[model samples]
Target: MHVTELLKDWPCTVTGGRPRVQVTGVTERAANVGEGFLFVARKGKRQDGASYIEEAIQKGAVAIVVDRPSLSELPLNVPIITVPDCRKFLSYASARLAGNPSERLTVVAVTGTNGKTTVTHFIGQLLQGLGIRCAVIGTIGIFIEGRRMEYDCPEMTTLPAEYLHPLLAYCESRGVTHVILEASSIGLANSRLAHCEIDVGLLLNIGQDHYEEHGGREAYIAAKGRLLHQAHAIIVNQDDTQCRQMADASERPTLYFGAAAMLGYSTDLILQKLAIPGHYNRLNAIAAASALIALGYTVDDVADQISMLALPEGRLQRLEQDGVQVFIDYAHTPDALEAVLQTLSTICYGKLITVFGCGGERDKGKRAEMGELAVRYSSLVFITTDNPRNEDPVRIVRDIKEGFGGDCSTVEAVLDRKDAIRQAIFRAAPGDIVLIAGKGHEKYQQTATGVLPFSDVAEAEWALSEKTYEGKVEGGSR
Candidate 1:
């Protein structure tokens, strides 16, 4: 694409030279700049892109977009355009460079504290079942045509604007009709999804999370709300008290989904029976399915497809051993933990056992709260390590124990996650349900220095098989 045509709609003040350069690509990072690349010198949280102006120029950048006026003082001969807000302009610049593929595809973005990944996967599965070529970008990984690329990064839950154009380009080339993505609070705060035109924006329930990064809960929610502005339709969980406030701010057509008995009118797509289990999962499914139904899919069509929708791995997943049941869930927040416990208490006719721990260097306020909730729901509570990255495991356990009233008898602290799981299993008698929370689908366990390979689901399966087989042999002898 020609540089002149691309910058024609960009909100920039041309300082030096006309927009005559032809552009090959758009890049924000200096290292990615190459021949004919239009380098965007924008300020970021940790580092300023303008600092790398000399480097980008050396790497064969054709133009530079900056928000500051001093960019004109540079001795470089490359054309420089000054925009009032380079971060805001970057969205359009990237879209213009990629030929605006978002305009062609039906983009459905799901944002909230939790359930973003599950909803994205659910919507992707539903769309695929309906014979549409759909792609998913979220915590689990990017899924293109039902195949996913498993890459793990600490902040990989959300899609970044840099990967936006290239992935959309790939989808457009493959003739994909729909794309579902998880838009995280941090992702929106950083202008990651600003460029993509959303067809339907679904906001699941919000809660306290990322306080360390967001500074507070309000800032985190405000970030998630940004997606609603660019959406064609907005869907939210009406049961959430704050959700009504978020919905009121939307100017587009809106709909609400929840399990509320008196919601003015019946839900367009009610979750009569959810195979995934948990009240929270049902709510997430209802909201996602309602969004699809509102997008023109029939209620019956969505309901039919949802029956076969398997729960995303490591989310309240169940295992049976010698009449004991174990559930593995990714409940890392207080609200999420509460929801999981309440759901388990409903179906669990026997004693409930919970094994959980908080990640180190995260929201420390939630540690005691998690412990309190775990003690409230389970007969036996085993506190253990969960990604204690660069933090002492013993200290993390001490904080968790604070919620248990210092009764070491009621709550046992096992720093080793494998030993924690085993102790919970051994303590469970027949008709007991053991819940392994925190690390659900994650494969690696992060310690103080490095990450050790581990899988919650795999370990649970192995333990269950061994216990069940041993029980069978003992029964035969009896």
Candidate 2:
């Protein structure tokens, strides 16, 4: 694509303007820039993206986009496109570069403190079941027609604007009719989904999370609200006052789903018989059902596909072969932990055991609250290590212990996460339910120094098998 035609819609002051420059790709990182690539510079949390400008230009960046005038003072002989907001500029320009594939595809974006992955997956499964070619993009990975696609971004829930637009274009090339995306608060705030043209935006529920990262609760919510603006239509959880408030202010068409809608409507069989357990999962169903209905499906159409809808990986996933009733979930936040614990308490026949830990450099305030909720619901609690990125793992554990009564017997701390899982699973008796919370699908734990290989599901399965083997040995000896 030519530079002039690609950025025709964008308001920019061009320096060293080369109207005939052909662009090959778009990126924010200097390391990713190559010949004919357009590098957009912006401010990041820890470092300014502009600092990498010299490196990008050196690596053969054909064009540059920057918001700040001072950052564009370099005498580089490239077509520099100066805009007011480069992040937003990146989104629009990348879409132009990718043939504006979002316009050709029906895009559905779902957001919340929790359930974004599950809800996004639910919508994709429903649409695919109904014979619509669909793709799902979220925390786990990007999927195109049921196959997980390998992209540059493995860390971001919502891919950055550069890679995101190209992914959308790829989806369109594959004949995908609908694309379901999981929008995180931070991603939305960063304008990752700026020019994608969302068809139906769904807000599952907003609970306490990422307080420190967003600087407070309101800012976090405001970041979430940005998705609703770009959406042509929106589906909101009426049970959440914050979602309701956002819906009330929206000028677009809206459909609401929650307890009120579920209880009031009689034909809602979609919520009752979900294969995935939990009231929160039921609410996730409602959110997905509402999105499907918004996209021109009936409650009956969704009801037919409801049984096939399952939770995403590590979401209250049960172990069938294991002797004890073991469930694993990615409930890192206080609200998520409380919900999962309460849900498990009802189905558990014997003692409920919970193993969880908080991440470092995250919302520390939720650590104690999660600990309190764990102790409140479980008969035995084992506090373990979560990805303590750049923070002391011991400190994180200590913070969690502060929430509950410091009875040494009631709750125990095992700093090593693997040992914690082993102790919890090995000690459980028959009819006991072991709920492993936090680090559900993640394969590694980010420590202060470096990332360590870990998976809660993997550790639980090993522990369960060992426990079963031990029982077999005793029985054989007897």
Candidate 3:
């Protein structure tokens, strides 16, 4: 494509000469620049891309797109296309350059503070059960035509415009009929999903999260509502007050899914017979079922798939060891923590031992709330470190303890996560339920320094194994 063709709607001027520049590719990162590529100089949190323009040109970039009109430092020969927001233009230019592959497949985007991953997984599973070929992009990673690709990308949380065509192209090659994605508030705010056509959008529930990045609850809700406006049909949780408002704002055809309505398809989205247990999960299930139904599946088809659906790995997953029940959930947010703890409270006739921690560098406001919920519900609360990235575990523990109102006999601080889990297991007796909250199926613990390989399921299994092995050895001696 010629430089003139790509700069449509973008303010550009050929300063030195009107040389016909034919660029083969486009990139926001200077490192990715190759022969005939157009490098976009974007201002990011870490560094400014304008600083790397010399390097990009050295690598044979034919054109450059930037927020500024002219730079004294930059070469006058290269065409500069100035835009008010380069990030917004990045999505459009990248999509056009990549051949607009998203138009070829039915794309369903799911966004919320919680249940986005679970709902996406459930939707993919339900579609698979209905014999439809579908692909999913979320916390678990991308699924293409039933095959799991192990590559991890931030695009899973926020669909980047750069990878949009590549993913759609991959799905197209694999014969995938539908694509399901978990769109985060950050992704929506940053214009990641701007160019992509969302066929259907599912809003699970809104909660106070990512306030630091989204500014406040209102801004976060507005960012999530962006998807609602773009979707052809919006499926929402009627039980959520914010969701009700979001549904009303959307011009698209809307469907309601919740446990409050026994008449809806979500009436039994979360059943007692499932491997995972939670009323909140029931809401997630119903939302997913309604999404599938809107995608053209019959009521029976939706129910069969949803009923047979199992919780993905560690999202509200449960295990039984020596008459003790252990529930592992990915509840990082305060709402998630409260929901999981409340569910365990109902199921555990004996006692609910909660082992939870807050992540560092995230929404710090939720720490105290999580602490309060843990104290209120659990028979025993263990406050521990959970990916305290760059933040002192002691300080994080103190913030959580603050929520306990100073006389916290029920809560104990343990900075080491593994030790916390160990102590929770040791403290629990027969018929007790141990709730391992946060870092559900994730294989690594993210710290401010680095990522330490970790998995809650693996740790729980090892603990269970050690106990069983000890029991067998004692029995053998007896």
Error of 3 at 169 (Å): 1.5
Model 2 regions more than 4 Å off? 17-19, 260-264, 405-408, 468-471, 474-478
The digit string of per-residue lDDT tens for model 1 on 1-478 reads 7777887776676656557878888788887888988888987877999899889989988888888998855667878888787766777777777878999999999988878878888888888888889888877677887787553323477656666767788888878889898888888888878888899999888887888888887888888888878788888888887877988988978888777521233543356645677778777777778777767887777777877677677777888867899999898999999999999898888889898999998888788888988998888888999999988988888888778676756788888888888778867778889999999989999886688999888777666655533326421111
TM-score, candidate 3, is 0.91
How would you encode candidate 2's per-residue C-alpha lDDT over 21-89 as one tens digit per residue? 889888888888989999988788788887888899889898888898986667878877889998888
Which residue runs of candidate 3 sit more than 4 Å off their true CA positions?
Answer: 9-19, 70-73, 261-276, 468-478
Over 353-417, each residue of candidate 3 has an lDDT whose tens digit, in order, gives 99989888778898888888889898899888888989988888888887877557888888788
In candidate 1, residue 422 scores what lDDT? 74
Give model 3's clash tally. 2
Q: Give the Å error, residue 219, model 1.
A: 1.0
Measured by lDDT, the strongest candidate is 2
Model 1 alpha-carbon drift over 4 Å, by segment = 13-19, 70-72, 149-155, 260-270, 446-452, 462-478
| Residue 202's lDDT in candidate 1 | 91
